[model samples]
Target: MDGIFDMLILGAGPAGISAALTAHARGRSALVLSSDPMNTPLARAPRIDNYPGLPGMSGRELLAAMGESLEEQGISRVTGRATAVAPFGGTFMVSAEQDVYRARTLILAVGAQQGAKPFPGEAELLGRGVSYCATCDGMLYRGKRVAVLGLGAAGEKDAAFLERVGCQVLYLGPTQAKKCEIKGTDRVTGLVADGEEYPVEGVFILRDTVAASVLLPGLAMEGGHITVGADMAASVPGVFAAGDCTGRPYQIARAVGQGNIAALAADAYMRKEQEKQK
Candidate 1:
């Protein structure tokens, strides 16, 4: 687990699994991370016909087949929601709760960010008083009150961790989170929820899927999709994006195709990097 991976794909959907398969074929060590593999949108689809060679197959069936493929290929899978991805030296650091992974190349196939939009000042005050990982930033608010807007089990764990860290935690379940508002100047100061305001130093927003932009800072985005080139390489070097997070035409075939391209692109990037390091 301490060894740096050649490619770290975020998500276990068709795109991510495809990327991992390709990476393995290319002889690269790849890791696939997903918080809730069972909850992937693909798994919810009753039937998919557009994908060739798999007519009349259920989404979950296809997903299971891909899982089996990964197992056969010996690709590693990790069950954790990635909170942040930051550049570290010539590689990258991916943080997921208590674990941190290092990779020379990154493939953001984490599907699309769904549900509620960001609150009024959430984006602008991201580092100031807003955070996604309670474990990563909870200690900064020690002895201070903070609001945790959690979506599922991951969010619940984040809130509990904040409490354990000595932060007076205000747990706003998913339903209440949608009605919450962040209010502050220069930094987070209060949270508005359910027609009531509570004083807090920071607000932690934890959800199953994180936006591509939020996951990797400085990555170019176009209307909620990660900007990519013809080779599937993202704006950031050593980073690639595929599937729904890349753009429209949300089809299984499209996602799988993009995942293939991303895997190849990552392999090429890693080769160039290794050559430079020599």
Candidate 2:
């Protein structure tokens, strides 16, 4: 809904919140983009016993604390899942459901892996009839049959919207999302639902967290994690990564430390770029 920001952190968990706090401290404006905490792994962590001074706290407590810190610092936030990211004119444009945000620098703090591995044929068919955001691509499928694969209410909403847009919608719930497979060649031919085939021209995937690779294409990854250097700089020049999304030792402390590094690194990068222009 807003225009542009100095930085856009793609999670509200430890790493994300930490990055936003650090960026704001360094005089950089940042926006936190995240889905509902109640649906994330952090919210389900039974107990966190090793977070330095904040030991033996429940997962929800730690999440709440981070949120409070972000708000106290006056950093703005958007509660939604980012479906895709595009690098344009040296800036990154992130598509989160119905909203699009642009930022000079990007931070990937999406905790851990999300959603099941992309459905078979899903990647190859992406943008070739398979899409992640309904509002972004629904118009392309107008008057055609399409299948909606999603894990939450968001999926149903997207399906309904498609119907309103003139597309015949096949609404598959979360249980079906886990079992269905994408069927297509040059494009999305259809979807195989629970062993039954339903022909469609498009498929929309609605998940709380889309895969990191899907978010920013060609984002270097190591062992299923975003690859980053000592500076927390991601392979993408204007992008940085932190926390579990970057690798192992998935601890709150690790996430917080990395988040801080990412924020500082992003600020430094922007400053260096400004110098280049001068």
Candidate of highest TM-score: 2
Residue-wise C-alpha lDDT for candidate 2, range 57-134, written one tens digit per residue:
889988998899988888999888888899998899998877889999999999887554578888788889988888
lDDT of 1 by residue, 1-278 (tens): 45999999999998999999999999999999888788777888999888889889899999999899999988899999887799999889998977999999999997877752567777778889999878778899999999998876677878888899899998988887667788998999999987799998899988787777777868999888899999999999999999988889888888899999999999998888879889
Clashing pairs in 1: none
CA shift of 26, model 2, Å: 0.6
Query: Each model's TM-score, in the order given?
Result: 0.88, 0.90
Clashes of 2: 0
Q: What lDDT does the true structure give each of the candidates? A: 0.87, 0.88
